[model samples]
Target: METGTTTSARYRRFADLEARGYSPLYDDWCTGISDDTELLAMLDTLPPARRQPVLFLGAVRFVGVPLEGFATFRSFVLARWPEIRQVMRTRTTQTNEAGRCAVLLPSLAAISAAEGRPLALIEVGASAGACLYPDRYAYRYSPGPALDPAGGSSVPALDCSTAGPVPFPQRLPDVVWRAGIDLNPLDARDGDDARWLEALVWPEHTFRLERLRAALGVVRSEPPLLVRGDLTEEIVPLVDRAPRDAVVVVFHSAVLAYVDAEGRNRFRETMLRFAAARDRPVHWLSHEGHGTLAGVDGAMERAPEELDGRFVLQHNGRTVARTGPHGQSIEWLP
Candidate 1:
């Protein structure tokens, strides 16, 4: 467990940097919690990894806590500490957001076009494989035309605002095969698992919740192959399963921050080894928080103001764009 002072700083940073513009309720809650010594001490009892604001809040919500003012929220949490703690320990913030596909389309399409072959996607830290079906979902990027699956419109039409020279794809990439690696892959067809996913959505973001449900429906109808194991250990085997005719594309979004530094290095090395051994073309796509991808950040010369709260999109270790956390917007890099 982290010290109370360190935990308090985390809450402050989350409130000021991440929650301020996105969710006012969370911003207020976190800001208040930062100064609440009692609450800080309570939070310090949990495992360090499980003490994240998102996990904590989601656990409480999952256990029937109402969205109320700081005092009420604190009271409910304190009263139901045992229940919330159990939930937190057992669950993770597996935000299987499909909207992220919008930001990823440009890169995926570019790979397919460059290699002149269909893609075989392998997502590390894939929660429910919701993100694996980028080709199945539709996209509507502002200052751009509508993009849909070859057949017709699809559920969860991901809408994203854009800026800069965003490389809008002419069409969705043809993904012939898809698989995912997760420590614990959620079954989209399971009611309990699906409900837990819905509960993970923030309180004020009804739109995100609706989108999640739509994505869940699509995934349930034809779920992708989700292998359960450590990311570094399972990734090579999963990639080897991809058809030789397709180009292997390894990608992830908002997942690596959970991994420690040593683990991240191991994952990087594994990817490099696999890419070198493959006779066919292989592309690596990463959409994670700034500084989350080691070398990718070194190429980014943007001011702190420009990079704040935006995810860094990289392809083959090269910076591509600064994207919104939930795929709301994209600021394409020059």
Candidate 2:
């Protein structure tokens, strides 16, 4: 595995990607970056956590998707090295995708019904806050009714198919107030920030771009309150601002993996403390990779293969279902 004295997570990530059927991008990078010492060195400049292949390529394509350069991955990347480095120094592969709303509404609806009131949303690693507007988006489910509002499709089209005992999410919860915290907060109103958010998407994904822009459009007139800081430290203060009448639900999707195990534990403990210190009902919904969440009672029994490389969606710290990495599809469990 070692042709040189240097080892990079970039290489390992590419290998993993190839196995997972994430084509062209993985093979292209693995072939190109492996041979180019300068490109590998530029990657070394990136923080260890941000050196994954997807982040690097996403940054490159953020400006434009590489099309003509497929013949030589090294040359294509080398040409953009300087610009990519400048962007990487500031950005953390941050994205504000709203597709997860399709999967999330089912849980949110149940929580809202139980609480008998509208829900307040507090999101961690929220990026540009598009996901903060899940209620504004429209959904089409396989075994479910059309989840559009009274009018036509309000936002972008979000479609998801569900299996098992997971019921169709017919009625959505009213999100009275919603806010988010991120390491580097992005504003959909800001040109550069919005462009960078779009850059985070792979070049082939026009549908995702449409969803992102649509979500941004929904919140443009009145964007959610996005605080810039660490999630573990910033969550409670934001929680304190929610309406007293609303049941606050703190949630995140595909976010905890970047957090170290200690940080993740701290986030959970802090939420537990916040919930216990009040009489109001508090909930945490997490949609993350299999091993990301620290302690869920029955979670350890499921192996990697059984989990199928999909993100696990949890409610109140319990495993409920496995979902596609980006929430494009879902499989419910009993």
Candidate 3:
């Protein structure tokens, strides 16, 4: 478990780097909590994993706390620590941000084009499987062309800013099959599950909330198959179920941090085996916090200072780009 000092440092980091631009309300709250010794003591009592700002803030939001001001929020939290603690214990941060698909599109397109076959997508931590339908969402990458599916425009058009020689996808990948593995798979059609997802969205991001609603609508039309299990145990079975004619692409975003170091090592070994087996074309696409994946950091060739506060995008273990946590930007590297 993390000590009070470590928890406070995490909150400060979240305030300055993660929430500053995206959610001013959250930034202020985190900043305030970082300095409040009483709040830190309360937060430090939770499991180390639960001490993260996202889970804490999300728990409070889930409990219907008004997020208008830091003082009011803190007061409510202090008075109802037991209620919020229960929420923190029972709920995990399953941020199913469909906007991430915009960043994954290029990699998926490249793999499909190279293999000359449609993709069979297997998302490791697919909360409600909204991201499983990247083809169903339109794209508007700034300083570049807009892309829509063959059937025409779709709801929640994704907009991402690009830098470097980013290979803007000429067309969406033809996804033949999709499945997901999650410890607790959520149903987008369920009201409470859907509301929980909305609560996870940081306050002040109206655009993200709108995109999430649109994505939920898309998924409800046809939900992908989501298996309830651990990623390491469930992945192979799920991948084996894919069509042989299609290229299998195993991917995840902001998900591995929940897995312990040993679990991550096992997952890395599993993917390496799949890549080496080459029974068919299998690719692993990972978008995660810097250094979260083994060897991805060494592959970057960039200094640590250059990569601070960004998610590293890797395609089959090769560093490709640095991306915004919510898919707001992509700075291509490879």
Q: CA lDDT of each candidate?
A: 0.86, 0.75, 0.87
Q: Per-residue lDDT for 104-214 in model 1, tens only?
A: 999999889988999999999999999998988888899777898988655768899999998888888998888999999999999878888988898889989988998
Ranking of models by TM-score: 3, 1, 2
Candidates 2 and 3, the one with greater TM-score: 3
Task: Give me candidate 2's TM-score against the actual structure.
Answer: 0.89
Inter-residue clash pairs, candidate 3: none
TM-score (C-alpha) between model 3 and the true structure: 0.92
**How do all the candidates rank in terms of lDDT, highest first?**
3, 1, 2
Per-model TM-score on C-alpha atoms: 0.91, 0.89, 0.92
Candidate 2, number of clashes: 1
**How would you encode candidate 2's per-residue C-alpha lDDT over 6-100 as one tens digit per residue?**
53544755655542355555565556566667777778766666666667766777656455444565666677777777777777777777888
**Candidate number of the best lDDT:** 3
Residue-pair clashes per candidate: 0, 1, 0
**What is the Cα-based lDDT of residue 103 in candidate 3?**
91
lDDT of 3 by residue, 82-179 (tens): 99999888888899999999899999999899889999999999999988998999999986779999997557689999998888889898998989
Runs of candidate 2 exceeding 4 Å displacement: 1-9, 15-20, 23-26, 71-73, 274-278, 294-301
